[model samples]
Target: VRPKFIDYYCPYTLGGHFINACNKDGEPVCGIYVKVSVERLNDISEQDAIAEGIDTDWLAESQDNYDCIADHNMSGRPTAKGHFSYLWQSIYGDDKSKCWEKNPWVWVIEFKRVQEQRND
Candidate 1:
């Protein structure tokens, strides 16, 4: 998923992270902001490792927060064998994590980009 801005401590170099307003420390740090949608929905099967597009169930569950649905489709976590990706989080510039202060249904997901995995 293309985030509005990237975090300085981003785990992945290819992709970026999301930082909340309060999460900023010291001074306001700039990030790599992107304005594109690369998120997709795919249906994969265990039979043949085939992937196809199907209706996303998460859409219905996204009524709580519209941004959640977009984040899910965009930065869904990557499995042991998957494609490029990133995670979304809300940092309100404080010791307490703002992202974690959401309902159980809502979540600030962790990004995992397989493309950046180390060969060693």
Candidate 2:
């Protein structure tokens, strides 16, 4: 699966968390999470992964691009554009404690099929 930019956070050392936004079987699809350097972010493209056989459907539709600054040594303050300027703020507004800047990590959820039970 291909990774698409979902949002940005300050604490992340490299690129922010990405999610596979493809709707398959009418359900949201999830992709693998990869840590990439800022330089690499500019160098890589979804097309490259698609050419390499990774599904691009999920990536093409849900890519978000935003800049994040990390105040690793001190607590975070509201951004110039209000607290909702960043994706993190939009997701967890007023609840600054849950902001990604405070905890920079991405969770990639994977889904799999399972057999169903039948009458004997």
**Best candidate according to TM-score:** 2
CA displacement after TM-score superposition, residue 116 of candidate 1 (Å) = 21
Q: What is the lDDT of candidate 2?
A: 0.39
Task: Tell me how far the alpha carbon of residue 60 in candidate 1 is from the true structure, in angstroms, after superposition.
Answer: 33
> Per-residue lDDT of 1-120 in model 1, one digit per residue for the tens?
222566455665434644443223433333333333332222222221212222234333445444544544545532311211112233232225533233223222233323332348
Clashing pairs in model 1? 22-92, 22-93, 23-92, 23-93, 43-52, 87-111
lDDT of each: 0.32, 0.39
What's the TM-score of each model vs. the native? Answer: 0.15, 0.20
lDDT of 2 by residue, 7-97 (tens): 6653644456555455543343543435433332123234443443443343234323222224222134323322122444556654547
Global lDDT for candidate 1? 0.32
